[model samples]
Target: MKKIVISISDEQYEKMDAHIKKGSALNLNNETFSGYGLILNNAEGGFSWLEVDMYTNLDLGDVNWSIEES
Candidate 1:
């Protein structure tokens, strides 16, 4: 597999941090894999979404997947 890095802002980082914690608590953290998803804008600037699961692994390099928000 290939590794690529993507940049996110600080506010997004915080949100993702909270999300992962909640997800792990619920056993819904998808960190055995990494995927890409999209948020779509709707009429009146609303939001819609889509996601794709692209990969899976038993380990995620040197970091713990759930808390590595950045």
Candidate 2:
């Protein structure tokens, strides 16, 4: 198993903050998780993804995912 992190720009962070303030829930879907789940694979100790209240539809042009250094 590997650790990963998502990086976002200040502007995007602000946008997300504002969206949350307005009670807009994060729009997550297949595009965000690729239909993967953590609970389903937890017993096997495999790779999977789980997110809560995070948006999937955004410019995300500068967003990036990277392995977390141990």
For candidate 1, write residues 1-70 as lDDT tens digits. 4443434456555655555555455454544433333232223433322222123112111211112333
Top candidate by lDDT: 2
Write model 2 residue lDDT over 1-70, tens digit each, in one string.
6676766668766765665543343224232333212111122334333232433432324445557765
How high a TM-score does candidate 1 get? 0.35
Q: What is the lDDT of residue 15 in candidate 1?
A: 53
In order, what lDDT does every prediction score? 0.36, 0.43
Worst 10 residues of 1 by lDDT: 56-65
Q: Model 2 off-target regions past 4 Å?
A: 24-60
Model 2 alpha-carbon miss at residue 49, Å = 15
Global CA lDDT computed for model 1: 0.36
